[model samples]
Target: MLFALGFYTLQALHYYSPYFSIFAVIAYGLGISVSADFVCERLKSTRASFMGRNLLTAIGAVAAIVVMVFTIKDTPPTASNANLAGLAQYMRTSTDVPGDFYDYAKKPSYSVMCSWADACKLQYLSQRAMVSSANQEIGIKGIIASERFYQATSEDEALAMLRSLDVKYVVAGGRLTVWHGDISKIGISGANPDKTVRVLKGDELPANKVGQLMAARMVWSSARLASSGVTSPLHHFRLLYISYYDSEKPPLLLYEIVKGARVVVKAKPNSPVAISTNISFNTRRFTAWHDSGTTNEHGVFSTIVPSSSSLVFQLNR
Candidate 1:
């Protein structure tokens, strides 16, 4: 058994042919043992023979000990060493997230939009829901949907897509700030076919494309705050926005805005309900209104109708 173990160890060390080494070692040991037994049997009556046997055994034991020591010393480092102290420190500090930042944990079930890598970390630490994880276990359709949301040309389109997915808060960060020319275009075709599948120069896109992306304002940015003496990691725009576009447009202007720790929207009666929002309203004191049961082309029905003839609802987060 000891010889077999030693043979296996040598094989692991890339010794010449495992089978050959095992056979050779076993044959050599057997030959030595047989020869020693024969000689001992012949010299069984002699004290010198007993001393010689003891001396041989001692030499073999010493050789085994030396081999074991060298084998242990030559062993390579493990893969676990890749995890450094800095990595642990980074993960520990990430959990010290600001309260003012969007907290998806408050909601019963809602998705927070962020890069896949950050999403994985936040999901683990916060125990909150996310749009898609870094592992992409949500499948290809989910990946394509998220890609479309990021690649959206207008706030309306982006909000509409978010509403479709029932997403409330959108997160912006340095990892998300891709240059126009550096954005990947290989996977699925986006809304803009001409620029969809290729990295595009800034000038190549339509005039409104850049403006629409800029409109999603940064409500909180960690890097921006740190520059002004706030101690935090250096990453641009670790901001969370309520994703409101202050435009008198068709889809956006028609919905009732609900902004709290996150944002929620309720479509007016008989108005288009292409957008959806998820905000926690249980803690606040607010009156409930009746719905007219009007459904849009998207099959989204109105939930809250105004009690008074003319009413305006506004909230700050």
Candidate 2:
């Protein structure tokens, strides 16, 4: 009774155990001991009391089976440890990092994004200062700041949060149960980003946390979006590595924030031009794209950015 009725937290979401789960061994044993004699004696009779016990136990057993069947994925820390292992190794290795990264112990680099219960597992394996963690090593305010960075729907807000925290690297994955929504899927929330509108501010219409971080820069999902001309491709951040993308391996991705490449374009005088690019990335895949500007009286347009690709320019008609 205590085991089945007591609350159990899975990936930080609290729910009552419904039936005889493996975790309820003690309860099962106790129940069996008490009911075994009752079962034998009741087999000789057809009273309501005996029937009720059998029916209730049958119902509970069924409920437990349903819950267990729906959750084939493993729980926290252990959930995707294999998937996250390679990315964690990359974080710890100095040779694999960009030119800006000195060392985890030596430089304030690599942001371990937070909020999910399983998140700390990655941070623990990375073995560095996470932006925040369930351990609360960075405290409540730090955790809130991390949450905002992940949850913010606006590019400015997300960048603000990153710059504010001096976060250079961002990581994604090891979480399967998304209780919330984020544009980049970097943050966790109860909102589904697909159904919700992405806004530039928390106070904007459809005032709920939807993610835009994935769109702010290139991501594993960006290729499909860019190919379909449905997305504004990655700019401010560069992909470092990703393991088992779009698979059951439960991918782990890493990216470094950078100052993008600057490109100047010559266009009709005083006109706002549209710009796009197809960026080859991580020496593994390609990601899009860049910025735009209005030309001066001289018909010269120039913009500095983090990265770029093949450039195509069109005047805003």
Candidate 3:
């Protein structure tokens, strides 16, 4: 009675309470073993009893199998560790991540984006990003740097801030809890750039957290590059282009298009020079381009491509 009924009780209790799975499994093993021993001793001397023992054991095993099969079927093949490994493989190998799968360390450069007010993660990102090049380490940095980061508090204020910073990149993913509306105006600037810029837009309404960071990184990297003279034969002079933001980054859509463009680039010590390029969905190709026009000698090249290709620069120099 205890064997059958007790097992049922544990199963029912543990099904809804995942925390108890290990304990329940242990209890079931112990209880079943004890019950088997008691039954064997109770009928020790009878030949017929041996047959009964076999029957009972078979029944118990079958019952356990039923429970296990149901549980195993409901649980994924890669439940925890295995599931995460599969996800990591997909993130690294797949060109586009599937919706069902997610990278455990989503933002390699940031630990994990937190609530805007989470000061701890913000500080950690800024201070610890260079500690390691590993994804987990980058995540630590991302979380800390973005801890105090908020989707623009206001369109006017954001625009003003961008203007003040002479900001080259601005990510526009809005917070559902805070800036729960369209952010079209937040990235717009009245000042014309001397060089060229690109914007990428996504088809998915309401971009995900990954999209937000990808956009921010593209812009951030672009802002850091300086102009160069030698260009890749692959890229020359071109106009605005289009590409799919299919990575764990922003989603971009563009109507106008160009590819294989090149631009001048310079970077700080130990940084690679970049050449602005565009991923053209229309052509199904990523092309380099050169930034024309002129700079004020500080090498700040700025020109507008399109708002849809939010990130328009690439490294080449």
Candidate 4:
């Protein structure tokens, strides 16, 4: 009983020392054995008492076996540990991370921008820094900064935000598209095609082009984009792009800007394609693109090669 009481006290105190629990269980079993022996000696003269005690003990043994069986049957496998191991392997093998980015002790020097859960696991398993984790220990400013970085109107803005946070690598996986409830309240709507609106505070959004230009300068001067080189059955690479927003519905007009490169656009089959370009234009200008043609059954379309221009695409209703 004392051992049991101590075990409960330790649990209440949140001291989950496994060795201490084992010792307590052993002491408890000894105490029960001694007590049972004393009781049996006193009741030795009574056959009825002995029979009752033996019957109760047998029932308790059977009940314990039943409970143990049920517990063993219902318990799920430890799949999360396996997943973490796999992630660690992936991070180690990834070519996207530069050699200098492997330094573990330096905070904010090299960190991954990803979902809270992935950030935590990657940080632990990879022994690298992460921008955010399951806990919001980075605080409101960090959260706001991350939001601005993802929803930036241009590459320059996004790069500037990454520089501010000292984030070296951007990781994208299944978690990137997964909808996290209430994330919209924090100005981070997930990659769901239906949820297109992105909100930002005045301070969070860049006030002028000067700051954006500075950010772009920093990116060109310091950082270099690379691929993770991780391949899976579903996709060729685990890390897609450095940007945070979805590829299908790019958040900004800057994303559509391609220089001497083929641009691919996907939409619902047979949807009309509207393409346009203007140097001094924002995302709003894309809405005015002239209708080109209806997409085929594959929902894919190619753009005419352009040298330097601000391009936009919209599906006609």
Instruction: State the lDDT of candidate 1 residue by residue for 95-139, as single tens digits.
Output: 233342244455334455554535665444343455666543232
Candidate 3, lDDT over the whole model? 0.33
Worst 10 residues of 4 by lDDT: 227-236
Ranking according to TM-score, highest score first: 2, 4, 1, 3
Q: What's model 2's TM-score?
A: 0.51
lDDT (C-alpha, whole model) for all candidates: 0.38, 0.50, 0.33, 0.40
Best by TM-score: 2
RMSD of each: 18.7, 12.5, 15.9, 15.7
Candidate 2 runs further than 4 Å off: 1-81, 94-110, 136-143, 173-219, 222-229, 248-250, 270-283, 290-298, 308-317
lDDT per residue, candidate 4, 190-212, as tens digits? 34445554443553433333223
lDDT of 2 by residue, 257-291 (tens): 76666567777799886566665544466655545
Off by over 4 Å in 4: 1-85, 95-108, 134-144, 174-317
lDDT score, candidate 1, position 303: 30
Q: Which one is best on lDDT?
A: 2
Clashes of 1: 0
Predicted structure 4, TM vs. truth: 0.32
